[model samples]
Target: MQEQKRPQFKVFNTPELLETILLHLDNRTLLVSAQRVCQTWTVLVQTSPAIQEALFFQSQEHKWHAESISSPIYNPLLVQAFRPFFPSVHEYPPIHNNTNENATEFQAEAEHHGRDEDSHFSFKALDMLSSPQKKTAYMRKEASWRKMLLRQPPVYGGVTIFKMHHNMGGDSCRSYEVQEETPQANQENKESDDDHKMLKMGHFFTAFIHNEDLYFGRFGHTRIYWSTYVPPYESDLDGRAGGSYPPQGGSYSRKVIENFAREIVRSEVVAFSREVTQCCVGGKTNLTQEESLRKEILEAESDDRV
Candidate 1:
């Protein structure tokens, strides 16, 4: 006896099918394959905000994005650049008299946070910068001086009055005073006052805020300078200008920075392709080997940490 033919399953609607495919496409290859299936699939993959956001978040979570990695890790740089400013508590003796009172106050303020003696005075600086309501009582005690210094520029005339002061424990801090320049004295005079004035105009502060800690630094010289890395502008691409490259014109603009980053990414992609080709030529046949190579490529493309 002839058995009844099994009923054929109906194909899902296009959107439903696309969604199902997307759900299963955790791997980049499979995702690309789904995109190539049809015009509808391609458009859905390309234009869906939810899908893009999810992909981006997942890639970042997996450390797959290059720009994310290349962003300069600022903490080390901050420590290096500012550490020399503070006096070391171990090598030198503490100041005496009324000045000793200020030192004690500074020490107490620093210790109240429970930070180790060797920690940079950045915490103190940050404390000073903090809001009135948030500042510790000790910080509030010295609020007037902090506020005055914060309001004033560190450098004036032909000298930088803010000399680096090291505490007894080797922590660094800045102390402000007039530094008179004597023409006859032995000092490094790399640039004239006129040159410095020109450079000041080119200088900008780049501030980076990470995990509630704020780092600000001056970059550039007479030809060009960058302001501290502030929070990304509304128009900023990839945010923080971390992946951005200096433009040819020696100026920082959104378009130029974006283009610079794109070019770097493009170059990285080209290099990655060459490496893959070389690996294949070397007779590497394992899929895992290939995947490892690809992962390395993606990492190399990620942000350049200074």
Candidate 2:
């Protein structure tokens, strides 16, 4: 009798079928796990246009496409992956009034969600290069997130990172704000369009590491006062230049939603820093003694707290 033959799973070998299936995955899974499945999967994820757009590697053009996405989709691989380092505005009670009645409410909500208010929320300026996550998966050359975009479809404005310091009776109240770039009518917009352009994960990390003092500050401590505004949509615009526009919580058009997101992200792009890019990507060996020591301390604190 002839030996029986077993069937081969040929579906996995088909690039078209594989691409379709892979596109269904969330950005994190696609970057962290799915691409590691096989050489074929790796190639498909790296090369497929649809997959690239979904990963935020390339810009999405359609207004309908942006509108269809209901929830606020942050950079899954960049921001979400290292979420602890980037706290949203909602994370804290108004920085000025930590002792306000709402502080209890915010703490209750944070606790109810299994989040630690102290660890997740920090008023101190933190060097992201010192974040524990950087020493692990993010530092690897094979990390797909390094190539990912900071935001999907690429917002028209840049990102804003401000550190605010308020001194009340010698007690300094400090906090950092990270929001999308606000479009000022000032001459600052005179810079090239690239100045307002979004950055890839690698480029963003490079800028953050190099512009450490500029962003977080080095002078024994002072507040970085910054304000953001909402641009009135054409329909919502009144005769008055700064008159009341529609409430933010109210329904918004695709244009309004996109514009809001655009202002938050595209206000002022950081100039790329080639020097620190090598330090982060290659290894910490090139980092100064102070930076290396700081990184170790932060990583240790994280381990101990856990």
> In lDDT terms, which candidate is top?
2
Model 1 reaches what TM-score against the true structure?
0.20
Candidate 1 wrong stretches, greater than 4 Å: 1-13, 57-169, 173-306
Tell me the tens digit of each residue's lDDT in model 1 across 70-99: 332122222222232221331223322234
Off by over 4 Å in 2: 1-8, 63-72, 89-137, 140-143, 157-196, 212-306
lDDT for each residue of candidate 2 in 77-187, tens digit (9 for 90 to 100): 555454533344224333223232333444345446643323322222433345657555445554566556655546443334332222222211111323334346533
Candidate 2, 37: how far from true, in Å? 2.9
Model 1, residue 1: displacement in angstroms? 32
For model 1, where is the 10-residue window of minimal lDDT? 268-277
Candidate 2 whole-model C-alpha lDDT, 0 to 1: 0.43
Against the hidden true structure, what lDDT does model 1 obtain? 0.29
